[model samples]
Target: MPGRGAGRVLCVSEFVRNVRLWFAPQEIREEGGTPDYRFSLANERTFLAWLRTALALIGGGFAVDQFLPDLRWAWRAGLALALLAAGVLCALRAVNHWVRTERAMRRGEDLPVSRFPALLSLVVAVVAVAMVVVVLTGWEG
Candidate 1:
C-alpha cells in the first residue's frame, strides 16, 4: 500500500509542477520586467478569444455528431472529427501564442508573428466546403 501510494504522490506532485510551469514558467517570467497592465490584459483577452473559438468548434463537432443523425456515418464522423481536431489545434495555438506574445512584450521585443490564423481560416474553409458538398450531394444515411 505504501509503495502504491508513493507513486501516486509522485505523480500528483509532478502534475502540479507541470501545471504551474504551464502558467508561469520561470524562464519567461524572470527574463524581463513586468509589462504594463493594459498590454497584459489585452494578451489575456486574446487568449480568451482563442479559447472561445476552440469551444465553439468543439461544440459544433458535438452538434454535428448528435443533431445530424441522418447524415451518412462516414461524413458525420469525418466532419465531427475535423471540427474536434481543429478545436484542439486552436486551443494549443492559443497557449503557445499567448506565451510567445507575453514573453515578447515583457522583453520589449516586437510581438511574435504566426501563421496560425491563416491556417485556422483555411481549415474552416475546407470544412465549410465539405459541408456544402455533402449537403448538395444529399449524403445521408
Candidate 2:
C-alpha cells in the first residue's frame, strides 16, 4: 500500500532508531522500561570488555607493524589493516550487543543469543594463523 518514498522513509527511520539504540542510553531508558541497576551495570561491564578488546586489536596492529621482523611493507600494512578492521567491527558490535541486552533486561525477556564471542574467537585464530604463516615463510621486504 505504501509508495517507494514511504519505504525509504521507513528504512531511514529504522536506521535512526538503531543508531539511537547503539549510542543513546538516556534515550533508551526514556523510551523503554527501566531495568535493574545490577543488570545494567553488568551490561556496561560487558561493553567495556569489548572496548578493551577493540583497543587491544588496534594496539596489536601497531605492535605488529612496529616490532615484527622481516615483513614486507604490503604484508605489514595488510596485517595492520586486518587487525584494525577487526577492532572497529568489534567496537560497532559491542554497542549493538549492549543495547540488545539492556532492552532484553528491561522487557523481562530472555537475553538474546550472542555470536560475538564466537566471532571474536574466529578472528583471533585467523590472525594467529596468518602470523604463523608469515613467521614460517620468513616474509621480508
The residue-by-residue lDDT of candidate 1 on 85-125, one tens digit each, is: 99999997788778778878989999988888999999999
TM-score (C-alpha) between model 2 and the true structure = 0.81
Task: Write down the lDDT of every candidate, Cα atoms only.
Answer: 0.86, 0.84
Model 2 spans > 4 angstroms off:
1-16, 23-26, 139-141
Per-candidate TM-score against the hidden true structure: 0.80, 0.81
What pairs collide in candidate 2? none
Please report how far candidate 2 places residue 10 from its true position, in Å. 12
Model 1, total clashes? 0
Clashing pairs in 1: none
Q: Pick the candidate with the highest lDDT.
A: 1
